[model samples]
Target: MEKIATIGLDIAKSVFQVHGVDAAGEVVVRKRLSRARVIPFFAKLPRCLVGIEACSNSHHWARELIALGHDVRLMPAQYAKPYVKRGKNDAADAEAICEAVSALWLKKTRKVPLQPRKFLDFCWYQVNFLENNISISGG
Candidate 1:
């Protein structure tokens, strides 16, 4: 079996599907894991980049994987859809995510000048802080 360099994970309510690929872009692994088995399965593998479709609990999974030393990215489902091959299924979705992730890593990035919005951001933070905090004793 080829050494897995990257993995695309398709998360669902109970069953989670994973599609892995080697550095040469060949499929290395394709398996279904239960919710209970996801962590143990990934724990045994060497550190690698993992791509996940952004959904309700994706952030939680990303955090867990990161804690295990895996670099994880949350990609929007719509972004991965165009790369899907034949049909729509968990496996297909995983494959699509892998393809999309591969493309993202292979592309060159350029530094762009960021627009300044200091005042706007400061006001937003101030408003949120005030709203979330309760004034107990004010002198």
Candidate 2:
């Protein structure tokens, strides 16, 4: 089988875990990064396949990474769950992402449409603001 470089990103609010494998299926890079540094990190990597779990903020990251010239694939978390071996941790999750991508079982995985980050951010901010106002009024 032809080998292809792949990266799996386990994203969160502030930190993210990344797992990478080369064409030969050899682990290339595995590390954790903060949200602030994730883009810059990928920006420095050579273009390759990137896999991320389809979740709350995934579309935003997917769009950003795709724009960086990498082939990005978003796999629903359910599809990735089985790949988890023993423990449930960032490293393990990252590895699962890598395995799921390289194995190509992801073709059937559902893909979520990308949403505008700014719009989501605005919605979240508005909710928070309303909550604060309600609290101030003892409601």
Candidate 3:
């Protein structure tokens, strides 16, 4: 089996789809694992990078994967959308995320370190805007 340089996981309620690729952007692993098998499966592999769509449960899964020694990153769903080559499904979504994470354009933009408070400020602005809109317009 080719060593997995990165793996993209499509989280679901029961069956989780996983897609892995090698450094050359070749598919290495693709399967659907039951919720119970996620950690044990990842534990067997050598430490590798994992990309997961940023959803409500993603942080929880990310922590679990990190504990298994894999480097994990959360990517918003929209970032992974353009990579999907076919119809929507867990398998395709996993493949899309797998492709998105390894996109070369990312190399150009990842030069700067991301600050946590920038995310906080973005969230604050969103909430304040919503509150003010609701209060003044009564919509």
Candidate 4:
């Protein structure tokens, strides 16, 4: 089996689609994983880059995957959208994310940093702080 070097994970409420490519750009893994099985599945693979579309819960997932030793990037959903090449579905979304991420890494003007846990956390904190201040001022 080809060793996976990068992966795109499309996560929904319960099911997740995964598309992986080897160093030569050959498909090495394509599967669906239940929410409960995601951690276990990735835990067994060697550390690799994982791409996820940025959403409300993507940060949490990124942190978890990072803990497992994988480099995770959260790309804007719109950025990945243009990469979809087939019918809309979890599988296609995953593939699109994979392609988008690969392209993102190649370019030098990335808006989001790699291993963005700290940046994300700081942003989250800022949002919360602003929300709290708004409520206090309004009440």
Candidate 5:
């Protein structure tokens, strides 16, 4: 079996799709894993780069993967969308993310360094904005 150099993971509520490629960009692994098995699966593989579409749960997963020694990158969904060559599906999306993450363009953008303080600030700002809007609307 070829050693996986990069992996794209499309995570959802229950199931997750994985797309892996070797250093030469050839697909090596494509499969679906349940939420409970994600960590265990990655734990067994040699450390590799993992790409995940930016979403609510992405940061959580990114931290988890990073803890296991894999380099994890979070690319905005829009960035990954352009790489999708087929219909919209978890598998296809995962493949797209893999390609997008490994593309040269990805190197040009600033990597998302997940920070708890930043996330908290954003959440607090949202809550304050919503509260102010509700009071003004009397709703």
Candidate 6:
């Protein structure tokens, strides 16, 4: 089997947990990073495959990571769920993501295409505007 380095990221609104494995499938690093620091932290890492769950804001981070010269793969959260052990937490989720990506069956996992930032941002702004308008009318 070909060896490859991979980093699994469990992203959230503010904090993100990362699990990194080397070519030998040995864990090289595991840490929690804040949203503000995610890009900068990965930017310093050696080029490797970065796995993330396909959820809100995932494509944004994936694009940023790819722009920094790292390969990024987006896996569905359901596909990654089976890898989780008894304990469920951010660190566990990150480790599960890494394990899932390394599995031979990972080829079957669905890959989420990256979303355009401009389009996503525009949608968010529209939603916020609608919410604000509703609040004003209700008040």
> What lDDT tens digits, residue by residue, belong to model 1 across residues 12-117?
9999999999998999999999999999989988998888888898878887787777877777787788899988899999998888877856343221112225
lDDT against the true structure, each candidate: 0.82, 0.83, 0.83, 0.85, 0.89, 0.83
Residue-level lDDT of model 6, residues 1-139, one tens digit each, is 1233998999988999999988888888888999998988887887888888888888788888878888788888887899998598999999999888778878765444446667989889889989888443555
Local accuracy of candidate 3 as per-residue lDDT tens digits, 32-132: 99999998899989998787888888878887887777877778788899999999999999998888777766442221123445888988988998988
Model 4: per-residue Cα lDDT at residue 14: 95
lDDT of 4 by residue, 1-139 (tens): 6789989999899999999999878899999999999999999999998889888888788888888889888887888888889899999999998888888454532333346668889889889989888443555
What's model 2's TM-score? 0.75
How many clashes show up per model? Answer: 0, 0, 0, 0, 0, 0
- The best candidate by TM-score is 5
Of candidates 6 and 5, the better by TM-score: 5
- Evaluated with lDDT, which candidate comes out highest? 5
TM-score of 5: 0.79
After superposition, the stretches of candidate 1 with alpha carbons farther than 4 Å from their true spots are 105-139
TM-score for all models, in order of appearance: 0.76, 0.75, 0.75, 0.76, 0.79, 0.75
Clashing residue pairs in candidate 4 are none
Candidate 1 positional error at 31, Å: 0.3
lDDT of 5 by residue, 3-120 (tens): 9999999999999999999999999999999999999999998999899998898889998888788989988899999999999999999999999889886975335465666888
Which pairs clash (backbone N, Cα, C closer than 3 Å) in model 1? none
How far in Å is the alpha carbon of 106 misplaced in model 4? 5.8
RMSD (CA, Å), each prediction: 6.9, 8.3, 8.2, 6.4, 7.0, 8.0
Please state the error at residue 39 of candidate 3 in Å.
0.4
Quote model 3's TM-score.
Answer: 0.75
Q: How far is candidate 6 from the true structure (C-alpha RMSD, Å)?
A: 8.0
